[model samples]
Target chain A: MNAPRVIDVRGLRYRYPDGTLALDGVDFHLCAGECVALFGANGSGKTTFALHLNGLLVGEGSVRVCGVPLAASVSAGDLALVRSKVGLVFQDSDDQLFLPTVLEDVAFGPANLGLTPEEAAARAKVALEQTGMAGALHRAPYHLSSGEKRRVALAGVLAMQPEVLVLDEPTTALDPPGQRDLIALLRTLPQAKLLVTHDTSFAAALATRAVFFERGRVAGEGGLPEIVNRFHWSR
Target chain B: MRSAARETWIVERWSRGSSPLHSLDARAKLAALAVYLLAIASTSAWTQAAVAGYAVILSAALAASRLPVPALLARAALILPFSATFALITWLSGDATRALALVEKSFLSGLAVLVVIAATPLTDLARALEAFRVPRSLVLVIQFLYRYLFVVADQAHRMRMAAACRQGIRRNARPRFHAAAGAVGVLFARSWERADGIYRAMAARGFHGTFPALAPTRFRTVDGVFLCGFALAALAVRLML
Candidate 1:
């Protein structure tokens, strides 16, 4: 049985305001229940491409998230719908966890989705439980360790219950044990994931397929071993 | 990094305390603060007594809050240097009473504000302002500023550390100032870029031009009583003094 595609992008291209072409006619997709690791160097357009998933950057592209073709004139309501369906955990947890408390930050997405305060709280609680951050719900984000902050950031996204999870640099500052814990946590989650990272071992652990970005295009794609070997990604 | 972390910690610590003052609704606390500030600002015949009364009220509130008294006073005293400048000028101009009163009122006012802040979280304070019909744009700016103050501070701290590591016992003081000025410009630019990225992340997660209220506020009868009681106390100080 062929699994349905969760994200389908054809002929995607993006350019920065300074006339730098970031993504040059790239194509990408994520199948349901499959985790795909996007391997790329800095300025390779992985992040720029991920930003387009939820209408954050409306670049020139044919992108569809859960069958929603992003419109150029996406309204706030429209973008919100897209965002709720596609949870993108940014590389910097500081950017994601902006609210005063962990629970409030987790509740942010659902609250934006027009959930009542009680419903948002409920969702936040469940997400915190899922990410093992239930105890840190009342704590300030800055007071948290890097690992805790990353988990809380994930909980914030998970609270929205998005079908697609796109995490950028999931293990940047995490210690070995923290990465193990995160990997274990990610294994339990059922959402299709798009992981943008240069961490080969991390990508190999969970990613069913891997894609490499080079010079604004997909340079290679296949099984993790094939992609890593083809791109010479690891030192 | 340590100082920035410590500064944020102090506020976080005070705000977490579950005192009666903390139990008061944010709007009620704000209303009480407004009344107290107004009473202090009024130039009345009994200005001296009002100032004394304000001090008494703030001290009582501080005691109820159960915050560290010395810490609270020190934080309040931070306002003194600026106020002292004006007070010193007033003293030189020959009105010793005015100078004394200026210092007295400013100290009391600072203490009063610190008391309210200790009792309420910054987010709650922003919510209170929103409830009071302040401009939504202004409240949004306040919320963003309060949230990102630490992020920017952390970034600045990291940059400072990098500069220190590169300094290696510098001797050129003039070049040091130039480097410091250059760093300031870079800091602001980086802050702007970070702000832009944060806004995009927010938009991606469906930030629809408003910060979602994590908990809705309901003004209870007790909140009403708290408001009335505090307002009346300030009013009594202004009038019966």
Candidate 2:
């Protein structure tokens, strides 16, 4: 009868080598099957916080995902496991996509997770279907429209079968229709989601709970509507 | 759907063809071109026949590619300035013949590379670099460059459109060089930030440096014949010269 905490971060602090502070004494927790939005303006440590979730940015505190401590002592093998278990989709689809074809890009994640080519392809197909990008499997990411690229990028991460999704500014360049499709997709994903965004409207639509980030720490946290109204967005 | 359909058509049109030249391994074509280059470089300035023969062979290759001849010509013409620079340097050295030779060699060599590219797909051309002993790192850089150039170009195009929309210029207005420089600076900073995110995505997916081939290439008997035949041809040309 115990609730599962999908992600646990305690006393997180990060400082750049140039002696600039990025994150200071941050603490957070995410539950399984929950959609949480991290809201903040640029340079508000939203990205820095997201990076720590995937072990991309090493910091001074501890992060435990699915009960495994993401400590410095964890081997590269463990990190790979964590990475595969938690997909990190970047803001720019250009950065998320580096392969020649959408299929290849989607296959990249599962292939790296030790899946066979057939298995990877099968997974990629399902992921692309989920994102409504099934027809673009052979198209180059570079050739895709901005909205298509965003969908393809989402598919790339989905193919990894991550238990938790960490998205940075997911709706930044998307059109209204694309944003709706993305929000709908996010609503259906069975995994926990950590969407970092500046779009309060998108945050309002997709997130069940919200965390406000300001100057590198969690400024406030509560239910979605409360945070939105408290932040003074009338909608 | 229209754009997607258009892209699909272009990719298919570029990728599908029935030229004997297209069927040939990229490595063979590249080596042959390299051998021709060496022979052209080694020949006497008076050997216009050799230069002419090189031009004829390259032209035939380009013709065989079935790509638009005008397009190929326009692309080749763009390189004329660099060739002319070499010719000019040779002329200043009091060697008119050497200048002609330099121009001829440069034109032919540059033409050869272009023809090869026109005949072969960029992916095949990249795979062919393996035969040149091109460092894997360099090959990867070139491959990624080719892959991302369109993305960067599209970004630049968008930025230009955005700027134009604000400035009330329809298109292709001559922005000052400093303005262009600022645009480039913005592009670079954006690209660098994107690259950081890309590295994370790549690392998340277990991208080691080596790009894994979707399918393995088989070296069949025909490949062997082509390799041997090209090697023998190069050797004969070397000996004859």
Show where candidate 1 strays beyond 4 Å: A71-80, B1-5, B46-51, B168-174, B213-216
Instruction: Give the Å error, residue B50, model 1.
Output: 4.5
Model 1 chain A worst lDDT window (10 residues): A71-80
lDDT of 1 at B131: 84
State how far residue B127 of model 1 sits from its true place (Å): 1.4
Each candidate's fnat, listed in order, reads 0.76, 0.67
Model 2: residue B221 alpha-carbon error in angstroms:
4.4
Score each candidate by Cα lDDT. Answer: 0.86, 0.77
Q: Which residue pairs in candidate 2 have backbone atoms (N, alpha carbon, C) closer than 3 angstroms, thus clashing? A: none
- Candidate 2 docking: what grade? medium
TM-score, candidate 2, chain B alone: 0.74
For candidate 1, what is the lDDT? 0.86
**Per-residue lDDT for B37-67 in model 1, tens only?**
9887885464677777777888778887989
Question: For candidate 2, what is the lDDT?
Answer: 0.77
